[model samples]
Target: MNNTLKVSKYLFRDFKNALLIFYGIILAIAVLMAALFLNVISQESGNASFGGFGFSAFIFLFVSGLNCFKANFKFLQANNISRKRFYYANIITLLSISAFMALIDASMTKVLKLIMPYEDIVEQLYKNDLFFSSFIWSFALFTLAASAGWCITMLYYKCDKLMKTIISFAPVLLVILLVMLNNVTEGALGISIIKSLTVVLGFTNNNPYTAALSFLVATAGVLGLCYLLIRRIAIKD
Candidate 1:
């Protein structure tokens, strides 16, 4: 546990500056976007919707995957850090970041609401009216997306030239496959999958906990696979 904490501390310190800078930039962008929305209000328009959370989620996920997960491995290997300790630290760090991001997200919503009490343009797609619910689901998404990014990057590192080539085409192939499946079945597979997920998670799209629960489940699976792949991964020069 002590070692895990140490690992987590080290990982956090390593990226703290970069992460802060990134967030600072994002904050500036959000404020600008909020101002833009306000401008629309000045014109007596009715488009009080803010999808900044989408951008927030993507940044949190991809940045954590690349900087927090993938980059840390190099330093850990050089410092002779234990794989087990690093793994624990990874979980801790990811959860912390996810929680923090969720806080920022919810906070922004509140800030916008406070600044423009009558403005309904600052929209949050997550239908939860409560801050806690919003935070829970946001954390779920952040951690899950980061975990997925970690797994995908790990796979890239572990792949051969041929494997990398195959991976490059995997997305296209996947889309084609799904299209064919949809055509053959004459069913809306994507909608069906979403419905199934909503049912399994015991929450609706409007429910704050819906995707959050599913994300947790999927994150666990992805993290397990990541651990297996990275456990014996060689430290590159």
Candidate 2:
């Protein structure tokens, strides 16, 4: 109980800092997206509602998790906390931040719908095939991205000189790989993987249970990998 509280406090402190920075970034992005939406509504005579905007919020959350890991790992090490505590703290912090960001995004979307003049814009946004599919995929992508960030941060945590370089470049490399693969392969790989996984899990798109199961599986896998990496690489000073 004491250990949990300690980890929670540490996690909370890190999250406090993250919340401020994340709020600014998300607000700015939201305003920009809103502007783009307005422009689209003006030019195309169609609703500007989009799924990419929501996915961008998730990406920002993942980046914030990376920042928290980089910051908290050093603090924990300096304060003589065990690596186990540090690992748990990181996971707790990441999950908490992700949940908070998700809530903020949902609320923002609702607010936009309420305040904007467009009728049924949100519904139309979800009706689009690309955006609708992305709603299912974004949760998994967000978890994976967060885990990848944690892995990269773990690699750089103990190395002062390489930390900034790795943090800045790793996400870019990952994004580039994903984009190139999607474009060149025509999503064959992605489709195959998703289909296989769905078959293995006995899931179909029509069932909400299937969606929840898929999301849980993806989150568990990412966090499991994150745990292993942290266990292996986290150093005690």
lDDT of every model, 2 decimals:
0.73, 0.60
Candidate number achieving the greatest TM-score relative to the actual structure: 1
lDDT of 2 by residue, 158-214 (tens): 456676687678879988897789778999867886888766443543333354356
Write model 1 residue lDDT over 63-120, tens digit each, in one string. 6676565568888877889777888788888888778877887677677666543221
Off by over 4 Å in 2: 28-47, 117-141, 155-191, 197-209, 232-237
Question: lDDT score of model 2?
Answer: 0.60
Clash pairs for candidate 2:
none
Residue pairs in collision within model 1: 48-121, 49-121, 50-123
| Candidate 1 CA-lDDT value | 0.73
